[model samples]
Target: MEYQYKEVRRELAARADTVIWLDHPFATVMTRLVRRTVRRRAGRVELWNGNQESSLWSVFTDPEHILRWGWKSYGRNRARVRALVGQVVVVRLSGQGQVERWLTGPLAAVGEERAR
Candidate 1:
């Protein structure tokens, strides 16, 4: 469930028992975005609606380019997720290490619970 609007996310969070927020740093987000976009472009992957990644140069020229969009929305997204902390159970993972730990610990427990 990837949501762009804060209102939608808030509504979804209200229904979910827990919401995992990846609070990665801007640099980390940009690096991953670059790698993903390059890989998609090189592989000629077809994204939704038969759309493929635009030229890498578009990052500089296109304000709506995925990379630029990610960069521009990062702060607002962070703030939106932060505001949901008390309203819902938010497990914010700030780094890869935290993410891995949650996967093996809390998340695994939830999975195991469902299996029983």
Candidate 2:
């Protein structure tokens, strides 16, 4: 599940057997955030509660803009997820390569096991 607060994640993790953490780099995260925001804004897509993305310029003027918020929270989020390593089973995928491998390897194995 997507959660912004550490307390919320911690609570959720307590009941979860495995937590998949996409520990991507800052550059990758920002790039994807910008791309998604631009696509949503350009397409006038409706987000949760009828909220649509604001002007891209809002990245500079709006402190609470999604892009800005993502940039500010990236490091803190990583640290929080890292702290969960020993508390629960966390499959931290750092790069796209690792993610691809995990999907085809370990995750696929689990799927096979469940199908048995």
TM-score of each: 0.86, 0.86
Q: Candidate 2 lDDT (Cα, whole model)?
A: 0.87
Candidate 2 error regions (>4 Å): 112-116
Clashes of 2: 0
The per-residue C-alpha lDDT of model 2 at residue 77 equals 83
lDDT of candidate 1 over 1-116, digit per residue (tens): 66566557657776877778888888899999999999999999999999999998988899899988998899988887787778778888998899888889856988999999
lDDT of 2 by residue, 1-116 (tens): 87567557767877877779998889999999999989999999999899999999988899999998998999888887787788878888999999999889856988989999
Clashing pairs in 2: none
The TM-score obtained by model 2 is 0.86
